[model samples]
Target: MRFLVFSLAFCAIFTYCLANRPKHDVSEDNYLELVREIEDEIAKENELKHEAREKDNLEQAREENGQEKAIVGNYDEPPYTDKEISYLQLAREVSDQYMEEIRRENEESENVGARTASDSLRAFSHPSRRTQMLAEENERQDAELETLQMLASGENLRMRNLPDLTAKTVQDDPTCNTKLDCEGKNLNLVDGKEFRTITGTCNNKLNYTWGMAGAQHRRLLPNAYNDGKWKIRKLSVTSRPRKKVFLPSARKISNVVHKTTKPKPENEDSISLGLFYFMQFIDHDLAKTAEGHVRKKKICCKTPTKATKFCLPIVVEESDDQFDKDDCMESRRSFVVYRCNDNVRNQINEITSYLDASMVYGSSEEEEDTLRTKKAGLLKMSTEDFLPISERATSLPCNATDVSTCYEAGDTRANVHPGLLTYHTVFAREHNRIAKELRKVNSGWSDERLYQETRKIVGGEIQHIVYTHMLPVLIQDSVLDQHGVTKEYDYKDSVDASMTAAFSMVYRYHNLMPHKLNLGRLKGDGVETFEQFNQESVFQKPSFVTRDNYDGINEVTLGMIQSQCPYVNRFMNAAARDLLFLDKNGNSFDLVALNIMRGRDWGTPSYTAYRALCGLGIATTWNDLTNTTDQEDIDKMKEVYADVQDVDLWTGVMTEKKLAGSISGATQSCLLAMHFANIKHGDRFWYEGSFSEDQLEEIKKITLARVLCDTLEDITLMRENVFRTNSDWKRCSDIEGKIDFSKWQE
Candidate 1:
């Protein structure tokens, strides 16, 4: 009691001294920091009093019960040590101080209003000035890719003016750029024409292959590793001791963080199942990383005693809810890229990184040649106007009788699920439809001209759908405008269009899938059920998509539009949580576990690194994760992870509370915004830039609803926003923004 009084007296004296000190003579940071320490001491004193009262209550309860037993059902957090209490105090101070900083800064904005929480979107207020700064920054900094290449060649490099970049190019025997590019073999010269190459090269004039197919994915932060080199980050990166902390087993983290006993709730946003799968489709189009040298199958589990470096199987402990005690989940590391003698490992992205419909048309010339018939500029169609049946021997993976159901597209992942196949089918049909329309106006055009023009149009329509229809559903419109993703972009070659590893980690949004895969049609509030399949059965099986005389396509299309997505939460659906990728022996891998392991396998940084990068401050303790989610989630995360920094990006971001007016959390939203913004501003062939104002308008008119209308023979009527369930249904003819191809006349 006396110590408390003396502490109060000390605080009074300290406050007086600081207040009387002139503002010009004192540092705001130092002042706030000292004030924070005083507040922390007060908080500690209060906690002591609270604990004394709780002890008294516990003693009274024990006396009344006639027992001296310890308290049960106490799920309270562990008592903090002195150091921990200090950290907790800093966390408490951060909230009010951070908010004040943002509010004060926001008031100085040119075109902004008052808002609480965060004033992060203020960067958009002066975009021209911002862009100039970015351009100037790029000019001053050497390209990271160049730096990596130079380090690979064992050359000493100063920050500025290194030797010719071409001297350090990888020893590729083929597929090199001509004299036009800064790097690449002087072998191929691709012209910048009306159409883009199947290979995502020549997108940048000064540096060809910046967004090229088969290039290495860019790293947003330096890769974290156990050995601080090629080894996966199986341990915490924290140099300071936090009570013998290490990264827990991925499976353990999964079972705890994603432990949901309640029935998984539907998305409150009412995002349709179609949009959920469309996210996967976008992933397939953008990044198709090459399969690892080692396969992710029975090899790792079978050879656990002598497992190679390439085989990092996920551990399943005795306490596992699903797997047997002895079983381990089969896993494989991504094929390591050849980055010379550098210890820092990197992975390869085998396809184009652009949001181009590489999923539909193929990213490489070889894949394009296989997909195209070179006849009338139309992609081949099978009987009943379905996607062409695959001729490749390995394409059909189902039972022999199900061969009839197998079909092909530019991306082989079309065989993975009905949603991807449905999307592939629609785009293939849309391509043929557009080619036929082009032939109507310009009969003199050759197959090459027709194919190129149609391809360009289809690609433009895709970019429009992703930016206009899909992104708005995922991110806020205000956010879109803030990030300049929705703005008219002038192509900037200075920007590196390569995707970051962080972006890839964010794309694993598998929790959005509902456990029961509904395949049916909806008429008003009623339903016309066709078939229902579980998650495991539909994978690698095409029969589900080709059933009922090919009515399955239409049924599944409607199923996607009508069914609601599972809400974005920590809960992994039972099917994904336990039944993912079942093998003949009844053993299966957990998707949630795989997501965590994969982030580590790729050497991606922990959640705190990305948070700091995205302007979400680095957390020193789990309590410091106040900006992330509710305390319940933080408690769950803290239970799994030993230290806050040990949490993987996939697990951390997935558990975050959704940002206001957005489906994703703040850090993820920022990273995604950065990605789309780069692709839009950096792409030489971004639709708005390549097309005339009239042609661009026609492109903008193409929405996802219009795409469905053109492709789905059975979809006579669909909701205006095909991605939204609450939208009004209308006949195909009544849908607005139908494409006008007359503007395409050259």
Candidate 2:
């Protein structure tokens, strides 16, 4: 049993030893073979390392040689160092330094090579030079076009002296002085013709170009038109005022904005005050003249009524004799005519007798002949009644040089033919009545209120001008029924010498019409009453049209709103919801309101809107921008906002710049005219001066009100811009010249 147990223990120990021993054992021969394989790999690795080092060392040696040569070449000497030295030792030292440099250079070279390859790859992937060149060309062309437009729109006068003047010219020559010579002179003369008053119109071929384009003729605005009535000429060369204000440079004038002020009953009545000056107009004729030594003239008639009463100085003596006041002629019954509120009539009577006796004597026939001759020059009358005087000198004395000079001293009234003056007087009377009615509504108003009211009236006048005359000119009579272009002008006159067109060619384009592109919101059902307009409610109404329909809709209809409303700022964003929003592609899309703060890449009409919002103050500063990822840019914008506020504070700074004087009357009138003219003609006039008759009719489709609004707005802008630019020029100056210093009647 002991022997069997020993066997089991021995077996267990043997099994444990076998389990712990190596699974595969090598003999000396196998181990030697493995060792040889390991040795071979180590040798190969060392060989590679040695080869790399040798190559590196060779490169270092070569680099060291090059540097030594460069150092010698650049500095003319080797740098000295403290060391035990020999030629080989020096070479080895230089080689060590160069080896490090070579290593660095290799790294740098690799880096540069990689960068060049990367750049090459990128260049290959990018768009071609042709595309870039084309883009550049397009940009350049766009800039040029913009510059041209800006130049054309600028305030500069193209005077008659310029070759481009489109007005008809009739040069006055001395040859056409005889009655038979008058046959060739252009005039509206007929034997025994009853004189009728007519307004003078500018007759220019350019003005009638539309007729040539198979469009209707355009007519000049009436003499009563504000722009027409007031020439707004540049101050005479001698009348130029000092542009700099007399006030201190830093001085600021406090502004007072009157909300509402009523005229007091105790205040002097404007009418009564105005009538005080009526004393200058009493009739001196029909007075009793005593016989012999300078007769003292007696009063013609007693004052009829308090309203019609006027103070007149009794003539104490005649020109031949000085004497005391005369009380005679009390029994002389006076035939009198008292026209109610006849300012001009009284004025004429006050001065006419002086002309009859004192200024010129026995010269009525001569005066009539001279006036007839002058009238012939105006092309409105004939010289048949006027005797030709090739060389004439006036011998009339008593401070009178001739009929014309005497007439001028009487305020151009006497020189103007009786027929023309009669018409002018009638027109003036009507205009004054209209002005008085306007004053009733405008009285006690602030400057802003007055400006707005005046603009509205002006707008109405412009509408009448375009619709009544200009439209007919643009669309010929044949097409008048259809309101389109046609090749016919029924109203033939000598003025229509160029038969190619019966209308003003300028109006024969879409840009010339007032209704072509209606941009105002006051069209259709949107027309608001005065009250609604005054309130904010007008803008609050739903927009019937939007920018998306802009191309298709009549832009003229929107002119009022365009003139009044903020075009592209907050209002645009607010209205964008209703309007069809367009992208650069003209594709309709939803506007991201936040993008306004982000700035637009495309045109946003931002400047126009800025002008409108200037009075509204709807914009916010950087502090107002919240949750913006870019805070730095926001901070900068805050600075810009402060500058903008400063600009608001310095409203008159522009006047200081003399920007007002820089703009001529022609510019102001042209701007106003173009605003309407563009609407009537369409887009052609926007960029070019040429237009077709079809374009003109398209313009006629525009509304009259919009044209007026645009015109008025342009005038207002011109005035404001001029004032701003020449704010510095505003200074204390005596209101002399033709301006009456007397307070204007309400």
Candidate 3:
């Protein structure tokens, strides 16, 4: 009897200890098993919820059939959809099931210690202490499980889960109709004349300190200057109001000059195809659309009889008749008007001189979110078969469910042309490559840190390329020196970098576009076979890069350098003239005409006025233009305009002979030089300024050639001067010319 009691007591104490062992102290295998069991239980609960939903549906159906259901008093709302009702039912069932499981588990854990420990064992082994410890352990395990569930649902992550709280909230003014009208309320306007300068209390509402840069008030209220309030000066012969000059129609001018002038393919003196693309990239970085019209309907032009308030067609005049008799559409569709923020008299009311890599990284919080992947702070790239590809293909995203438009980094016009798209792709890839390198170097750095650092480096590269390679070629060294655009770094508050109307008009160098895109591969022996593609065919198409195992981009890069650009003249390529967009019914619109019209619409003074402003000789007669332009070009202007004073800036600039050792004419070169000089002087974060000595050194090493070699795939050989067409192709492995990114490493 004694032996039997001793053995029973020993067995009891051993079992009690085993039962009371801490539930949190789980072995690896057992912990995994527990997780699997919990997952299985959750799955079973979902199944039960689904079944409960089905049963509820059946019961409701039976009740409806058995008796006439009475409607709730005073409520006439329609019943919820079957899917919606079912989802709600399932959610309720799941919640109830989860609660019941938790309660049952708690009860079982609490009773385990009590059931295992007998009265004699409890006295000797301290049952209350063991039970309390077990309860505490169970609570911890429950808390941990809950945390795991939350983590799995991705609720704990910072940028990934939370809404962007830093987004700007813009309030629209109800009284204002147009952007110009909003500014007019505060300004004193002369009868039949537009407000030339911001006077009075108008300066108080518009903040020039941190707001957009404008042309007029260069010091205190720069953003308010020329807020679409300037009027085109009238010609000496015309009696039209200054605000309402009866200028020639954009379409009519296009038909006369652009349609008549055939494509004159004249290669630039020494500039490369890379330079052309880089210019376009820079254009997009600085400018955006002024608040203007939008197209109401796609078919608005087809049926003029059904014209509404939204339909403002570009009426083609009889004198400029270049279109075929049968195919000549009477009504060319116009853009629909969507005014900018009239309250502030600015587009988005943001400073334009920041040059904060808005072209690559994006400008707004929403845009930033769309561009970011939230994984290592890398910008999102369009993928092919789950493999990372280029910047999300322009028109469509990979996972787009509908025909809605897709997103791109920085600018919307980045994918408007093939060359622009190629550059965007290279820089995007560069950002990712740098981010990956940074991650490797600083193992503990987060995605945000890596992305920002990479962005800074890319911005620096752009600044270096523009200032070093492009500016020298565009604006001659003499003009740069005259304008004080020296390499010396200084931030001047008085210098306004706002894009002037003349600057914007002159920058439209569509005449430089080649008719055909030369696509070819550069061989090891520095020879290549060019495959010519019509420029219109690849306008917004990015799929061309994926051809030949993604080697087409390199081929095109080489081809652009090899192909010659057309001379800057009235003539345009057939691609730009004949097929700008399919919706326009085979190039119904003309780009040159649009440029002239846009300049006038923006209320910019004529070429003579701009010449006077720049301290050059103002031409009063057609013969006076001989000093600035060729004799033949002057005769062409006489036929178009009544007097030299009426000549549009765009027409005059394009016709002028290219300045000696410069890509552009005198007026264009001057405007570009002044604008760029101001952009450098005014910008607080100009790459050369406020950088560490080491950072500045690294930035100076960056060049367009290095950027191309580093970012482009399989670009083994590259010319030293990427901005110029040359036969000196050197291997990318040549360390003499290559930029060393080691200094950027943490």
- Candidate 1: which stretches are off by over 4 Å? 1-192, 238-245, 295-298, 393-401, 522-527
| TM-score ranking, best first | 1, 3, 2
Estimated TM-score per prediction? 0.74, 0.14, 0.64
lDDT of 1 by residue, 606-661 (tens): 89889888788878888778877789999998887777888899888888888876
Summarize candidate 2's per-residue lDDT along 1-746 as a digit string, tens digits. 12222222233223332464333333433432432333343334445454445444434533432222222122443421111111122223222333343345434433111122112212111221222232223222222222222222232312111111111111111112222221222222223221110111111212322112111112222111112221111121122256522211110111111001221121111111111111111111101111101001212223212111111112212221111223111111111111122211100011111101111111122332342222111101212111121121111110112222212111122111221122222222222233344455546644333322222232233233333433332223322333221222222232322211001111111111111112333333232212112111111111211123321112222232232221101111211221112222222211111122111111112211232222322223333222211344334333322322221111111111111212111111122233233233321111112213443333333332223223222112111111011211111121111111112233
Tell me the tens digit of each residue's lDDT in model 3 across 213-266: 221212111221123332222233343455434556555555545553455656
Superposed model 3: Cα runs more than 4 Å off: 1-237, 240-245, 255-262, 290-295, 298-312, 319-354, 384-407, 583-587, 735-746
Clashing residue pairs found in predicted model 3:
293-335, 293-336, 293-337, 294-335, 294-336, 294-337, 295-336
What number of clashing residue pairs does each candidate have, in the order they appear?
0, 64, 7
- Which candidate number would show the highest TM-score if scored against the true structure? 1
Pairs that collide in candidate 1 are: none
Cα lDDT computed for each candidate against the true fold: 0.67, 0.22, 0.52
